[model samples]
Target: MKVFFVTLGCKVNQYESEAMQKLFEASGYVRADEISEADVVVVNTCTVTAVSSQKSRQMIRRAAGANQNSIVAVVGCYAQSEPEVVAAIDGVDVVVGTKDRTRIVELVEAAISMRNEELGIRNEQPLSVVGTVDEIRDFEELPHAPQRTRAFLKIEDGCNNFCAYCIIPYVRGRVRSRSLESIRDECLKLKAAGFKEIVLTGIHVGTYGRDLRCQVSGVSGQKISLVDAVKTVLDAANPLRLRLGSLEPVELTDELIELIKTDERICNHVHLPLQSGSDEILKAMHRPYTTKNFAELTARLVDEIPEISIGTDLIVGFPGETDENFAETLEFIQSQPFAKIHVFPYSARAGTVAATLPNQIPSSTKKIRTNSALEISRDKSKIFVERLIGRTVEIIAETSTDGLVDGLTKNYVRVYLPDENIPLGEVVKVRVEKIFHDGVWGDYVD
Candidate 1:
């Protein structure tokens, strides 16, 4: 059988899609290049925002339209939150939630067989239901080795931080961490598989071991932290580079900062989301930290790791945010030494508390604020890249196309070099020559 996958959302989703692909491949199923030719289709959906959910629905319909005979499966956050909505769609044969993804191959096969058997009897069969995310307890670790040059290893799943504007915790359920032994084993396997870089991903990676016995093991031997998990991976796998995903500000302890500072393998890059830089707006959004706290943390990180690339997420036009609040946010972001900023226009989903909040900014105002934020982000990014000129950094060659080999530096700079017969996945040192577009033009060094 042949399968086509449509993956949406964050890196965690991408990792899960790859894992599912590996599972199908192991069962003698080949991957179809397009939905039109596939025997089965899997749509790994995202519900981060209403837009994401809409796209998920569109992709599901498109997949079904492309191949009416195919067994269409819709899974992930969208399915977890609204399985009934997905099942109501015409061509979805199976609806699997955030949980039970490991058994997707079996479910898809069974779905195909069941649908075929019942096709002659009736054309209005209900879709098969897998498990719901609410009952999810253990972290479902994917047992497949990653195939890419840079592997995203999900060490944790779900989130307990129910921010007012987020539907993630509702759809993803509670925090569940993978065991230390499992992490070590996976790290070893990925390293053995020749992946040079490993990016640790999760719904909320900062609270990695909060639910486990190692949550408070500093003075004792009982608790484990995200720092401990990183150390374990580094010690066991010793990958050339280790990168972390988005981290909560509250979780960035002095010890964690120190570990990143001293550890040579850990990339000197951090993506800390500062949703709304104004304290008033932050409170309205139910974000625990204040603008002052965020500023101090960024200052401390810059002071400790001078060359570190700091990135952030910003939400413009959030509820209760006035013109003054937006101005304060701009001022606060300008003061920080951020290398890149992911600016998002406030998107109020149906179930989020912020959706019902007063003083919701209009779409035009949101766009204006978003544009201004993007301008500031571009300036900051330019400054960061300019600072890299004449400096040599290590990069993993990701792809080569059109006589140019493109790769990302340790500090997350997208560097491009002229095609030099450089092998993909091989780490090479490049000296930055000039800033090109959002990245830099670099020449390979021996």
Candidate 2:
């Protein structure tokens, strides 16, 4: 049998899809390059925004229609959040959610058997294995190995902070951390697989150990923090470079900062999401930190790690965001030492507090703000790249096309080299030459 996968959403979702692929492959199934050629089609979904959910639905329908005889399976956050909605879609045979993905192959096999028994007749109801996310306590460990230069190891799952604009907590459940030993094992495997970099990813990575107690002999009732997980990955994998997923500003403790500063293997880039710069809008969104707190954290990071690249997520056009509020946000982001900005117009998800709040910003206004923020982001990115000119940086060559190799530096700068002979997946030094398309062009050094 051949299996084709359509993956969407965050890195965590991608990791899960990769794990499911391994399971199917291990069970003697070949991977199908085209959806139409597969015996089974799996659609791993995302619901971070309404747009994402719509895209998930479209992909599921497309996959289902691609091969008439294929067993269609839908999984991940979108499925978890709205199982019935997904099951109602035509040609869907199996519907699993954020939980119980380890059994996905078995579920697909059973669905396939049922389809064959019925002479390829569609089942009256899809096989749904979704459970309440809030009740989940332990992290589900899925077997995965890197197929690329950089491997993403998910050390945590779920979220506790119900940010007013987010639907993630409801779909992903509370914080469930993977055991340190499990992390070590995965790191060892990645190291043995010869991956140059390992990125620690999670729904809320900074909240990694919030739900677990320490297992050390001397430490009693002490909670394991993200710092411990980082230490474990460093000790076990010792990869050429290590990178962190998006982190909450409040959870970036002093100890973690110190570790990032002292550890040479750890990348000098941090994605601390400052959802909104306006304190009023932030409070309305129920984000815990104030603009003052976020400013201080970024300042400290810059003061200590002078060469660090700081990136952020900004949500503009929140409910009740006046002109003054937006001006404050624009001024604040400009004053900061941000290397990049990911701008999103406020998307009010259903079942969230912000959705029902008064004075919702109009779509036209949101569009205007989004474009303005994007302009700033482009300018900031160009400035950051300009600073890298004539400097040598290490990059793991990731892709090659038309005699040019593309890669990313540890600090998250995209560098393109002219020589395609630069081995993919190997760290090579490159001297920044000039700015290219969306990144910088660099000449391979040594």
Candidate 3:
């Protein structure tokens, strides 16, 4: 059988889809380059925003309608949250949520056989494969890494912080961390497979190990922090570089800051999502930290690690955000020494507290505010990359085409260099020559 996959959403989803592909391959299934050519199609969905959910539905319908003979299976966050809706779709043969995807090959086989046996029977009974989302209390560890120079290693899953504007916690359930031994083993495997960098990713990465104890490791019986997880990978795998996903400002404790400052192996880039810069809006959104607290953390990070690139996420038009509040947010973000910013207009997801809140900002206002913040982000990014011109930095070459190679610096700045027969995934030094499109043009050094 041939399998084709359509994946959406965060790095976690990407990693999971890769794992699913491996599962199918292990069962003697081949991969198809296109959905139309496959005997089995998997639609890995994302429901982070209404837009994402809509796109997922569209893909599922298109996959089912495009090829009537293919077995259409829907999985991931959207399926977990709305299995009934997905099942009612015209062509979804099998449906499983976030969990039980490890048994997807078996489920697909069973679903196909059942459908064949009951060809004329009404498709009344839904596929009996849905897994309980909340019952997932243990971390799902998949030791597979997608083929890439940098691999995203999911060390934790789910979230406890249900930010009012987010639907992730509901779909992902509570926090569950991968054990230190599991993480170390995965890292060693990825390193042995020639991955140069490993990115620690999760729903709420900062809260890793908060609910679990170290198991069968040197740190056994002790609670592990995000720092401890990183330390484990550093000691066990010793990859060229280790990167972290977005983190909560409150989780940037003194110990964490000190470790990042002292360790050169850890990438000098941090992305903190400041949903709204206005304290009033933050409270309304149920975000725990204040503008003052966030500002202090950024200040300390810059002071300690001078060359660090600090990125942030900001929402433009949240409910109850008055003109003054927006102005405060705009001013606050501009005042910070952020290397880059990811601007998002508030997307009110159903079941989120902000969805029912009054005083919703208009679409025009959201557009204007989002554009303004994006302009600031562009300026910040330009300033950050410009400063790196003429400096020699270490980077792992990722892609090459037409005699041009592209890679990312340790600070996560994309750098393009003329092809020098440099092998992909090889860590090499490059001296920044000048500012190019969105990044810097560089030449390989030695």
Candidate 4:
């Protein structure tokens, strides 16, 4: 049997798709390069915004239409939250949500063998959040283990924050982390698989290891906290740098700051999500941390690690977010001068508190705010890249692009070195010469 996996949304979704691919390979299913050729095509969906949901629906129709009789399946966040909505469409044969991720291979097989109308799986499973932080499963060993320069190591899953404007907590359930033992073992496996960089991702990475929330750090040799899990892995690791995905500002403890500062293998980049910088909007969003604390944390991180490139996500036009509140967020972004800004205009999600809230901003205003933020983003990014001129950075070459070998700096900067000899997934020192709003160009030194 041939199967195709179509993925969308965040790193967690990507990891889940990879896991499903592993499941299919185990069941004697070969991966098909094209959706038309595959007997079963799975559309891993993301519904963060109305646009995303629309795009997913379009994919479902396209896949189903491409091959008239092909069994089209939908899974992940979108499928979990709105399975009936997806199934009501013509193409989708099976709809599995976030919980039964490993069951895709079987479900696909069953769909092909027995044609049944299992349309609505929405809210069919347990309403209570289900997952374990201690029992970590790294499906990296499955066949076709992501052949790439950068690998995603999912150390954790799910979210507990329940941010008002977000639906991930509802779709992904509560926080669950992979075991410490599994993490180290997987790191070794990725290293052996020729992956130079590993990005640790989850819904709410800050809540990692909350089940037990305590462990004896080998580096400390003391009964320490769970926050040191990354540190412990770093201490034992000989692999290249490990980068972190989006982290909540509230989760940046003193211990974590110290770990990044001391550990050479830890990347110098941090992706901190500041949904909104205005305290009023933040409170409305039910975010745990205040803007004051977030600013203070940013200052401390920069002060301790001078070369750190701090990236963040910001939401504009949130429900009840007044002009003054939006102004506050813009001003804060300017003050912080983040290396990169992932700007999003707030989109009301169904079954979320913000959906029914008063003072919903017009879609026009949302676009305006998003555009303004993006202009600032370009300027700030250019300024950050310009500062790297004449400095040599350790960059892992990803691939050759337009006659220049492109890669990422240890700080997550896209760097282009003028050498093709440097193999993909191999780290090399490159001296940066010019900076563009898009990326940095450099000459490879080592």
Candidate 5:
């Protein structure tokens, strides 16, 4: 049998899809290059926004229409949040949620068996295996699936914070951290697989180990933390580079900061989501930190790590955001030493508190603010990359084509080398020469 996969949303979702693919491949199934050729089709969904949910639905329908005989399976956050809706969709044979993905292959096999037993007749109801998100406690362990040059190791799952504008907590459940032993094992496997970089990803990465008792060898009963997990990965894998996923500002403790400062293997880049810069809008959105708190944290990081790159997520045209509030946000963003800013127009999800709040911003207004913030982001990115000119930095070559190789720096700068012979997945030092396209052009330092 051949299987095809359609993955959507965050890195976590991508990791899960890869794990599921590994399971299918190991079970004597071939991977299909096209959707129409597969015996089974898996549509991994995302529901971070209403648009994402719509896209998931569209993809499912498209898959179903493309291959009538293929067993169409839907999984991930969108399925977890609305199992009945997904199951009711035509051509869906199996519907599993965010959890219990280790059983994906078995579920698909059962679906295939049922279809054959029914003489190829389509079933009215799909086999759905969604459970309540809140009841989940322990992290589900999935195998390490490395991408081309970098390997993503998920160390944590779920979220405890119920941000007013987020629907993630409803679908992902409370914080459930992976065991320290699991982290070490995965790191060792990635190292043995010759992966040069390992990125520790999670729904709320900074909240890793918050819900778990110590499982490390030396401290069995003590409370574990993300710092401990990082130390474990470093000790076990010793990869050429280690990068962290998106982190909450409030959870970035001083100890973790110190570790990043001292450990050269840890990347000098951090993606901290500052959803909105206006304190009033932030409070309305139920974010934990204030503008003052955010400023202090960024300042401290810059003061200690001079070459660090700090990236942030910003939401513009939030509900009840007056002209003055928007001015404050723009001014705050301008004053910060941000290397890159991901500008998002406020998207009020259906189940989120912000959706029911008064004074919803109009779509036209949101579009205007989004464009303005994007302009600032372009300027900030240009300035950040220009500063690295003439400096030598290491990048693991991720792509090579047409006599050019491209990779990202420890500080998150994309550097391009005009050499096709450079092996992909090998970390090479290059001195920045000039600004090229979206990144900087560099010459091999060796």
Candidate 6:
């Protein structure tokens, strides 16, 4: 069987798609180059935001249109939350939620077996089930990276954070992590596969290893924190660098920060989420970290790792955000000046705590705040890139554009090098020429 997989949203979704791809490949399936030629198209959907959910719907219709006779299976968080809405689409034959990745594979087979004329079109079958989706054990299998450049090892699943704004914990269930052995084995395999980097991904990475503690000794066993996980991968010394996914601000500790300084292989970039810089607004949104604590930690990290690229996620116009609070947030961001900012206007989902909160900001206000934050982010990013000018740095070459190849530095800055001689997965040194709007332009030094 030939199959195409479309993934949206978080790195965790991408990791799960890799897992699904492995399942099909193990079942003797060949990956399709395009949706039109595939026997099945499995869309690993994301619903982190309203925009991502809409994008998922767009991909489903696009996939269905491309292959009218092919089996269309939609799975992942968006499907888990609104399977009914996805099922209503014209061409989706199977809609699986967060729980049934294995079942989704079976459904794809069933869908392929059905005749095109017999397939339902007008209305989608209902699949709006909640809570844990997997009835059986999680497959212990580790999925290798689809590309040779990088690998995503999902150490944990689900979230217990219950932030008033996020729909993930509700859709994906409470936190569940893979066993220490399983995580190590996958990292080792990816390193053996010639991958240059392995990103440890999850819904909530900070809360990793808590669930698996009961499985072994140490009585509240230090089964391994995310830091320990990174250390394990580093110990393997497969010549692969370690990069972490988006992390909650509260997760940054002395040990984790120290690891970044001590481990030469760990990337010098950390995505710390500061949803709001106003404590009152944070309380209204039910985020655990206070503005004061977040700011102090931010300063502390910068103090320790002077060259670290600190990126962050910020929400504008959250519920009950007063004028003073918004100003305070703007002031806070200006003071910190993050390397990258993921700015989002608040979208109230159905069952989230902040959805029903009073004093929601107007759309116009949200737009204004978003623009302001973006402008600052762009400036900060440019400054960081500019600082690298004339400095020779090592980077992982990934793609080429306009006769120049581009790759990311250890700090995760994309740099363009004037060389076709560089292979796709090899790390090479390049001297910075100039910083572009998107990335740095440079010449290959060695």
Top model number, lDDT: 2
Task: For residues 1-108, write the lDDT of model 6, one tens digit per residue.
Answer: 798999898888887888888788888999999888998888889888888888999999998899766778888899888877888888777888887675656666
lDDT of 3 at 285: 89
lDDT of 2 by residue, 1-446 (tens): 99998999889988998999999989999899899999999999999988999999999999989988899999999999889999999999999999999999999989988877888898768899998989999999899966667899999999999999999999999999998889999999988888879999999999988877855447768979999999999999998899998998998899999999999999999999997879988998888999999999999999998589999999999899998999899988888888899998888788889899999999999999888888888999999889999899889999888999999988899999997478899988999999999789989889
Where's the lowest-lDDT run of ten residues in candidate 2? 211-220
lDDT of 4 at 118: 39
Residue 295 displacement in candidate 2 (angstroms): 1.1
By lDDT, the candidates rank as 2, 5, 1, 3, 6, 4
Over 4 Å off in model 3, which ranges? 118-128, 214-221, 401-403
User: 265-362, model 1: which lDDT tens digit per residue?
Assistant: 89999999999879988988888899889988998998998589999999998987899999999999998999999999999988889999888899
User: Order the candidates by TM-score, highest first — what do you get?
Assistant: 2, 5, 1, 3, 6, 4
Native-to-model Cα distance after best TM-score fit, residue 25 in candidate 4, in Å:
1.6
Query: What 10-residue stretch in candidate 3 is worst by lDDT?
Result: 120-129
The models' CA-based lDDT, in order, is: 0.88, 0.91, 0.87, 0.77, 0.90, 0.80
Of the two candidates 1 and 3, the one with more favorable TM-score, higher being better, is 1
Better of 2 and 5 by TM-score: 2
lDDT of 6: 0.80
TM-score of each model, in listed order: 0.95, 0.98, 0.95, 0.89, 0.96, 0.93
Best by TM-score: 2
For candidate 3, write residues 1-446 as lDDT tens digits: 89999988889888899889989999899999888899899999999877889999999999988777888889999998788899999878888888787878998888778777888342445474776667678887664747567888889999998899999988888999988878888878887887878888888999988987745457667767898898998888888899988999999878888888888889999999998889999999899999999999898898998688999999889998989999999899999988889888898998899999999999999999999999999998999999988899888999998999998988889999999799998887899999887789989899
- TM-score-superior candidate, 1 or 4: 1
Report the error of model 6 at residue 131, Å. 6.3
Q: Mind sharing the TM-score for model 3?
A: 0.95
- Model 6 lDDT-worst window of ten: 121-130
Name the runs in model 2 displaced over 4 angstroms.
Answer: 214-220
